[model samples]
Every structure is written in C-alpha cells, then in structure tokens.
Target: MQLISTLATIGFVLPLFLALVGVLLARRDYGVAAAWGGGVMMALLVALAIRGVLRGDPDLPHFPSGHVTLAVAFYGGLLAIYLRGGLNRDRTAVPVILATLAAIALLEGVSRILLTEHTWVDVLGGFAVGSLGLLATGCPWAVRRIRAGSRLWLAATLAVATPIAFMTVGWLDGLIRHWVTL
Candidate 1:
C-alpha cells in the first residue's frame, strides 16, 4: 500500500503518459496540454499552502493529501482533455480508462489512511482541492486554441514541476518546508 501510494504521488507519471497519448492520438494541441498541467500545478501549490498554514499532525501538514489531490486534479484533467479532444470513434475505452483513474485515486486516498500518512479529513480535503484546481485551469471548458509558443508552456511546466517532485521524495521532518510555507 505504501509503495503504490508513493508511486501515484503526482511525480511525472500520469501527466507525462497523458501528454504522450495526446500527442499520438489527438492533435497534441497545446491548449489542452497546458491546461491539464496548469491545473495540477495550481492544485499542488494551493494544497501545500493549506497544509502549511493548517499544520497536519506532528509530521507534515495533514489537512490535505497532495498525492490524492494530484491524482484527482491531474488525472481528472487528463480525462477532460481526452474527452474534449473529440475522439468520437471507439468510445468503448473511455469509460474503462476513466474508471481506472477513479479507482486509482480512490485507492490512493484509502492507502494514505491505511498507511497512516493521512486521515479522512485529509483525503476529503484533497478531493476538494483537486476539484477546484481542475476547475480553475479550464479543464471542463475545453480550451483547444493552438496559440503560438504553447508548447513552451508545457516545457516550462516540466521545468517547474521537476524540482517539486524531488521535494516529495522525502518531506522535511517536523518542519513546514513547502515553498509556500508561511
């Protein structure tokens, strides 16, 4: 449970995989890609800020689970892009894929509790934060405009997210150490 939860923690897996799929199957429009990544970024930063301020348990902040937030916001945004990109044919796999992501998010949340990394409140907070982030980045709005230099936005996101990913490897013990820590 710990291992799976760790692997699912917003590292570079889901977004990268979805990006590649978008490039291969869809038009690889920068709007969709940028929005998806932007949503994840926004959610993560916001969640971290909340955790810092609220202070969860004695270790790291515990109001929200960043892993669960990432799973929902990032994976949920991917579903939005996948559907909005207009893959009308062969719709059979959509539900299956969507269900799989939902299951992953749910299990990740549960695993966090089982592993004592978070509580029910943390998981619920994660869901809320993730949803807000997804909504903020225009996920369900279907922004497909292919403006110039949109690809640069994705590269920029990667540049920003990479360093943060390192932080998730092992959070600071007994110290509120997020970039947004108050």
Candidate 2:
C-alpha cells in the first residue's frame, strides 16, 4: 500500500518536474515548453471539473479517483505527446516516457483499487476522462495554437492558471465534503 501510494504520488508530481525540464530545454524553441505548460493547465482544469461533477452526484455511488485522473491526464498525456514528437521531437525520450507512463498507470490503478479509494469502474472512468482531456488538448490544432501564443503570455497563463485550477479543485473538494455532510 505504501509503495503503491508512493508510486502514485510520484506519478502525480512528475509533470511538474517535466515542465521544469521543458523550460530548461526551451532555448532552441519554446513550442514544447508552451505545449507542456498549456496542456497541463488544461488537463488539470478538466480533471478537476470532472471530479467535481462525479462527487456531486449522490446516486453515482463512487468517486472517480482524482489522483488517478490527474496522473493520467498530465503525466500520461504529456509524455504521450512528447513521445510522438509533439514537444521535444526526441526519439530517445520515447522509451523512457512510455515506460514511465506504464508504470504510473499500473501503480495508480492498482493503488486506488487496493486502497478502496475507488472502484474499478471509477478508476476506468477516470482513465477515460483523463485520456480524452489529453487528446483534446494535444491535438494538432491546439498544439499549433499553443506554439503560436506569445511566450510571455504562456508564462503568465501558467503562473496564474495553475494555482487557480488547484485552488478551485480544493474549493470543490470542500464543497463536496460539505454537501455530503449535509
């Protein structure tokens, strides 16, 4: 259980490190950095919204695992795009990213189930939602838009958007807790 949680937590936190790496690697072109920043922000917001909705449904009987969703949407999605040359165009990253994502998915999925944090249905739903959210943000058109956006704007957007999204999720989580207690 501890090992599983640690893996899930690592999977959850890996994207932030990847974003920093993207920044360091952005000297040649900021497209990849911009994509990483923008995609993650988008994924976080979408995952939070989905989590809120799932928690609000009294009859739903399951909480879609937010941790699992977040790990997949940000880590899995970003790594997938990076692997496909959407970001770095580095073929060498393919194996590394693929292995990392597989490990994350396995760990997160198994942990959520073992801990009874979510049912299999909930975990699967989270995975699907996360994947779709990533797909939406990682599309060619979205990538082009992110690449075309000004670097200053991208930086500012990430700075502001990331915190707001997180705060919103916190707020929503609280609201759901209150509702349940009521």
Candidate 3:
C-alpha cells in the first residue's frame, strides 16, 4: 500500500509539474493539449459507465471522484494560463499563486484520505491524469486544429462534453464500487 501510495503520488504530481514547465516554456499549446486530454479521458470513463449500466452492473460509485479530477485539471490549467498571461504582476504574485494551488492540492489530498472514497494514489492519480493532458494535446496537430477552427468550436465541444464527462465519471464509479464489493 505504501508503494502504491508513493507511486500514485509521483504519477499524479509529475505530470502537473511537467505541464507547468511546458506552459511556462512558451509551450502554451500544451495547455490546450491537457484540456482535450482530460476530455478524452472523461469520455472513456463515461463509456465504461454506460457499458456497466446496460449490463446492470454499475461498479464504482465514484463519479464525484472523477469530477474532482476534472475540477483540478480545469482550474489548474486555467491558473497556469492566467499566470502566463501576465497576471503575475507583482513580485509576490508568483508565491501567492503557488500557495493557493498548493492549498487546493493539499485539501484535495486530505479530503480523499478522510472520506476514504479514495486512497492517496487515487487522488494523486488525478494529478497524473491532468499532467498527461498537458502533454497529449500539445502536439502540433492539435495546435493546428485550434488555429484552423474558431474558439467557438472548442467552446461548443466543451459545453457538450462536460455533461458526458460527468455522467461517465458517475457511471464508472458505480461500476467500480459494485465490482469491488463482489
């Protein structure tokens, strides 16, 4: 369990750190890449949920957990973007930003531990997922799509996809829970 927990933490946090670097190094494209990656991951999770529902064997009961991941990724990415956009105006800005994000991360970690809904690894795994998101969408192809199409397309995709993402999270969570009890 300790090994799993430690690995989970590394897996979860490493990606975010990498993504942060990418975002900071003028690889703004990585930010979009991360967002789309999250969307895709959520979509896959949702698909699993639908399958479980049709089979009448909802497994996990951890949809909110999925949302928690999404929230972290979404908000973290947003903060990264804001910082990149020159919001770090004062010298204290960077520290303030880091502190706030750290607090959120700590809260998330502690909350999961207390709730017992997830192990440390599971919570940290969210961080890993978010990090991969940063790398996955940073490819040149993705940049082209974002450039060729209007922001409207991206926005529309998000609007339609968000609910699907949430549903998928819920459904898979149920399935996982059901399976574990068996």
Question: How many collisions per candidate?
Answer: 2, 0, 20
lDDT of 2 by residue, 62-171 (tens): 55566666667666655544443444444675677588777777678778889876788778876776676567546665354333324344345445544544445445
Off by over 4 Å in 3: 1-64, 87-89, 136-182
Q: Candidate 1, residues 1-182: lDDT per residue as tens digits? A: 97658545544454454444355334446566567667877888899788777775564468788878887887676566555544546789779868976887888899999999888988999999989877965754546644344434444555565455556545531133343343
Q: Enumerate residue pairs that collide in model 1.
A: 56-61, 56-62
The superposed Cα distance between candidate 2 and the true structure at residue 19, in angstroms, equals: 4.5
Per-residue lDDT for 87-172 in model 3, tens only? 32366866776677555655665666676766665556555555544344343444432322223333354446444544454455
What local lDDT does model 2 show for residue 86? 42
Estimate every model's Cα lDDT from 0 to 1.
Answer: 0.67, 0.56, 0.45
Which residue ranges in model 1 land beyond 4 Å of their true spot?
A: 12-28, 56-60, 139-141, 145-182
Error of 3 at 120 (Å): 1.8
Check candidate 2 and list the clashing pairs: none
TM-scores for every candidate against the unseen true structure: 0.68, 0.58, 0.42
